[model samples]
Target: MSRPPRHDEATLLDAAVRLAAAGGPAAVTMSAVARESGAPNGSVYHRFPQRSALLAELWLRTLGEFHDACLPVFAEHAEPHLAAGAAARQVVAWSRAHRERAVVLLHGVEAFGRAEWPAAQLRRERQAARRVRQAVTGLAERLGAETPLDLDRVSLAVVGLPLAVVRRHLHAGTPLPGHAEELAERGAIDLLRGGGS
Candidate 1:
């Protein structure tokens, strides 16, 4: 008998993401992932012991990827406002390039039952949270207290505004407008320049 090709964890996770994107979290069963990926049910189960594990892994992995993409932008721009603009641009650019993953992120962890995730996965979530907090704190420190910027306002300009811009398209299942990145960049910069008023 011929053996089935082994599908790696990424392939399986990719399938899961597609399923979630297409039909929401309810559609992401192991069998559905196996069917979507053209892998056997056993293969899906082999990588993810249960649905919760799969969901947790997918959510965490997606967040990790987004955070990873943005981390370098801070270092790339020494100025806090420039860095904020970079972050806003990154949010739009990343979402445009990876709409499916972006949808999952917009839906957030609660959709994937994050509260019930296993202990280890919860730890992973906490670590990701720390990285995000650290990035924000570092940026705030660089901006300095004398500056008009504060963590709350900077966050709104860099993260909140960009997310709001993308969330509309993702929720509607529409392609982001061609001007999305430019608009996001301008909005972030203008907000910061205006002292976030």
Candidate 2:
């Protein structure tokens, strides 16, 4: 059998994550990933083929991982408000658990060259977005949302509010505070209950 390659796709991707986390999407070139992973330049090219491909894979993987962590929390609670709070708190908790990936996500898909992504990558991005929209819509409906504004409130409570908390700390390169989960949970519940008057 032929000898196994020294560097794998996952290894290269992890290095890309580090580079993106440290210096944003502009840092994650194929050459940079190779250098960061100690892999041959050809190895990265072997997996990614182009800089846009590498960026797309890195962004999709990070986004998929985040959705995996937060979406399940929505299904775990029977009560809509409880589910919303849990989902919000999960956003902060996942960020705390995966700091580098969190930072990568904070850079957003546009920063990852989404406009240049291959069709397959773009489809995957849409699928992930659909999943989030479905979950948020379901929760909002369960919470008696009747108007577009009501849906917006639920979206803010479960997604926007928690992300704001994460963004504040991560953008500053500061660790999330110890009470982040509680703060996220409480803020989400308050938003859901307060309503727009």
Candidate 3:
């Protein structure tokens, strides 16, 4: 019989996230994660070769959760307008539910040093970008707007507007209002309808 490893990868990452949340990314060194997680330093290195890898994993993991929560709305709804609203709502809703994760995500690549991320992590980021583009394009066509939908406008609607709602509360270290999701939904619909610009 074999004994299971005491400090798993998720444990170390969780420690990293907490450290990052508490003291920012600068506080997330391997030694620090080990101490924070009560794991051996060797275990931290086994899961992540360097601090950059840890930062990359932290970034990718949080964004992955965001995409998982948000993308299904786009895939499931037939009405582009409703789908747009739902996606926006989902963004704020997810952020509100995962406040610490939201804070990390709101910091973005600047906190993680995008240039230092490994190639595989960069590819995942690119794939996420592609998916967002495809969803936006498809939704624009479904809406049948008179003007062609550019990436910028769609971004403003789907990501920028919703993010604004989330950022205000997250930055202030306050809980978001219960109506945040609904407000985001309306903002996204208006932006999509070409009335919010």
Best by lDDT: 2
Clashing pairs in 1: none
- The estimated TM-scores of all candidates read 0.92, 0.96, 0.90
Which stretches of candidate 1 lie above 4 Å from their native place? 1-5, 145-149
Tens digits of lDDT, candidate 1, 111-177? 9998889999999999998988788777777766345446787778778999999998898998899
Better of 2 and 3 by lDDT: 2
Q: Between 1 and 2, whose TM-score is larger?
A: 2
Please, what is the whole-model Cα lDDT of each candidate in the order they appear?
0.86, 0.93, 0.83
Q: Choose 1 or 3, whichever is better by lDDT.
A: 1
Q: Model 3: how far is 7 from its true place, Å?
A: 1.3
Each candidate structure's count of clashing pairs: 0, 0, 0
lDDT of 2 at 188: 94
Error of 1 at 34 (Å): 1.1
> Worst ten-residue run, lDDT, model 2?
188-197
lDDT of 1: 0.86
Candidate 3 accuracy as TM-score? 0.90
